[model samples]
Structure formats: C-alpha cells, structure tokens
Target: MTDLDPFTDLLDYPMYVVTAQADTERAGCLVGFASQCSIQPARFMVWLSKANRTCRVAERADRLAVHLLRRDQGRLARLFGAETGDRTDKFTDAPWHPGPGGSPILDEVPAWFVGRVEKRIDGGDHVGFLLAPETARNLTGSRTPLLTLHDTHDITPGHPAN
Candidate 1:
C-alpha cells in the first residue's frame, strides 16, 4: 500500500465540532474528517473514532449537528478536542440550543447544519456517518475564515484514533 500521510501533510482542511443527542445523552467532539460527498442530493459525511464517547452516543442519535468554527474561535476547538467527554459534561461550559431532531447546536459557531443520519459505514478505526442535511444556518455570510487542522496542532486528541 502506498503511504498517504505525505499527501495530507501540507493540506489545511477545515475542522468541525460534531454534536449528537440520543435520549438524554449528548456528545460532541472536534472532528477533522468530514466533507460534502454529494451535490444534487446534498449529502455529507462525518467520521468519528470508535473509541470516542461521542461516537457511542452518535450510534443511537437520529441526527447530528456539524458546526463550523471561525478562525478566532480556537477556544471552542480546544474545549471539544482536548477534553474527553467520558469524564466531563462538555455542554456545561458551552452554550447551545436544541436543533433539528434535538441535536445540540453550539451558539458560538459561525455556521451549522443538522443532518439526519442516513447510514453508518464501517471504516477501520472510524465510523462514517452519512448525513442528509435537513436544516442549516449560516451567520457569517460565508466570508469568515474557518478553523483548520493546521490551527489545532498544539492540542491532543481526547481519544486515541486507533
């Protein structure tokens, strides 16, 4: 197999905070793997590590909210990325409101969308949630620079990828 690490070393793809709600349980995590996979049908996919608590909650969640953080919102990124949800209630410090299907939507994000989980695909260490967007909100007029992986190098993952 060819090494794919080098290909993404210079790429600075935008980061996202993915939140989910199942029953009374809620989980959110900083995600690096997500993208719009379709055009006409308007589909998106977010990959969550199986080891993370958010992935566990997301398994039972009917919907997931993907939030786009601005370049200046690095604190929110660290809050979601560096802390593990297993031992902490991440929502206590972060202000949010129930969104489509009751998924938690961060109030501080520049843009966000709630999508129904259409399918879950097994992808080695991560599970890809295929989403069909139902509701979306954009407050930045699509002009704000988004937080990217390159901006989050200092923080460590709350859960190990493998």
Candidate 2:
C-alpha cells in the first residue's frame, strides 16, 4: 500500500457475469478482466481467478457462459461479485437456464452467451480461457447502460484469489 494502488486503475471497463457448468453443477462470478480478443472469428477471453470456486468448476467444463449486466442490476452484481461461491450457491438466488454445454446463463442480464472453451492458459493468479461462442442471446437493447467497475463500489470480492 506504499505506492501501489490497483483500485485507482481498476475503475474503468464494463463488468460481466461469467458462468460455467460441469456435470450437474454450475458456477459463475462477476468478471472484470475479459475482452473480445478476436474480431475475425469473434472470440472472447475471460479470466477467472484461481481462488474462485467457479474457476474450479470451469476447469473441467467444456463450455462457459458470459453475460452483460445493466447498470441498475447493482444488486445482481453484488450477489455474484461480492459473495463467495465457497459457501454460497449463487444460482439459488438468481434466475438462470442451462445454455450450451449446460452452462447456466443468467436470465436478467442484458445479454448472455454460452461458448465452447477453445483453450486455457495459466496466468499467474488467474487462468485465461479463450471462448468461441456457440449460442448467444440478447435480452436488452445495445444502448442499455452497462454495469461498470465504477458502479460496483459497494461490492467487494468475497473471494479474492490474490
């Protein structure tokens, strides 16, 4: 805390709810480090913290689901953003459905998709998964106010892997 201030630089970018399924179990969390890495093939990469319970379930998953939350869905963000999957069943409180490969996609998000895991790379504290979308759904308008890091000030990671 002497000179390093990650929070100062973390306020930008949109927040997303990432989900995945393995067997009968589904897991997800609010992801900050994700991007559309490829435009030609329309690929996206989402980083899951190693300490996240979702990460563990995703390890054996062949598909993952990603969702975009509205700015007004602050409470939804906190449920997945601040609560620890370690002791909480996130789906119990959120409405969702099994998408491609059985990945649970949140129902209230503006947009959501189930993707096939193309590849995975170890990135120190987190694991990056490259996803090729298999099926997608747009639940809201593109002009919707998306949830951003700035809107999640009241929510803290219940499980900080780092």
Candidate 3:
C-alpha cells in the first residue's frame, strides 16, 4: 500500500454525481474528490478521473453540475459509480433536467449547483475542474444526510484507475 493510504483509508469522503455537457454529448460520474475551495468569490472544485468518459466531455464543457444524494439514495449512487457512460445511458434511467449552461441536474438530488468552468488543473491521474458558482439550490432547508465513501465500498469502478 502507498504511504497515503494509511491516512486516507481511515477517513470517509462525501460523494457527488458530476455531470457535464459539451455540444450534444453528455457525461457524468460519481466523484469523491470535490470540495469548496473559496468563499469570497465562491469557488468549488471537482476532480475527474482521466480514465472516465465524464472527463472527456468535461474537457470540452463550459460548465458542470454537481449533485449531492441523500443517504438513502444508494441505488442512484451505484448507477453513477458502477456504470460507465461509454456503454450505458445513465440519464435514461434517472430523472434530470437541463440547468444553466445546459448542464444536467439530477432531479433526485437534495442539493446541487451549476458552475462555470474557470480552470482545469492536471493532477496525476485526475483532472481538477475549478468552478465559479453560477447557481445553487438546496431543496432541504436543513442539512440532509449524504452518501459517502464508506457507503460505496462494494461498487467496482466501471473504468480503470489509470
């Protein structure tokens, strides 16, 4: 195991479903590498795996949508985390609508945001998309329980890590 694994494996990370649209093509995937990076200007970042189809589409996209699923939405998490867009139409099975910049906003999520892609950073096996929030929604007035890495241990990623 890598040195980082010892510390990293002890923590559970929140998961998100990130979607991107470029031209007529749409793609999305379950991501664990995301967080708010700024407050004054309000910026968030999501890291897309280089091996996933979502990264390809996100590369050409002007915006992206990030969705937070409830604790009970394990089925939706499995759909995005274990399924590959290369051979599967994930949107066909889920409910969604077009948001700002034509990003797909999953209808089942409790909280979400559409962000303009401000920059892309190449970080090893993942590409980090830095976003400036354009719009955000919180369907639940209170904090909702979220799905996390600890809850998705059984899902085998649809693509290679590298």
**Best of the candidates, TM-score:** 3
Residue 82 alpha-carbon offset, candidate 3, angstroms: 0.4
TM-scores, all models, native as reference: 0.97, 0.92, 0.98
Taking the tens digit of each residue's C-alpha lDDT, what string does model 3 give over 1-162? Answer: 888998999988899999999999999999999999999999999999999999999999999999998989999998999999999999999999999989999998999999999999999999999999999999999998999999988889899755
Let me know the TM-score candidate 2 reaches against the reference structure: 0.92
* Candidate rank order under lDDT: 3, 1, 2
| lDDT for position 25 in model 2 | 78
Q: Please give the range of 10 consecutive residues that has the lowest summed lDDT in model 1.
A: 1-10
**Winning candidate number (lDDT):** 3
Models, CA RMSD each: 1.4, 2.0, 0.8
**Per-candidate clash tally:** 0, 0, 0
RMSD of 2: 2.0
> Model 1 reaches what TM-score against the true structure?
0.97
Candidate 2 regions exceeding 4 Å error are: 1-11
lDDT of 3: 0.95
Which portions of model 1 show Cα errors greater than 4 Å?
none
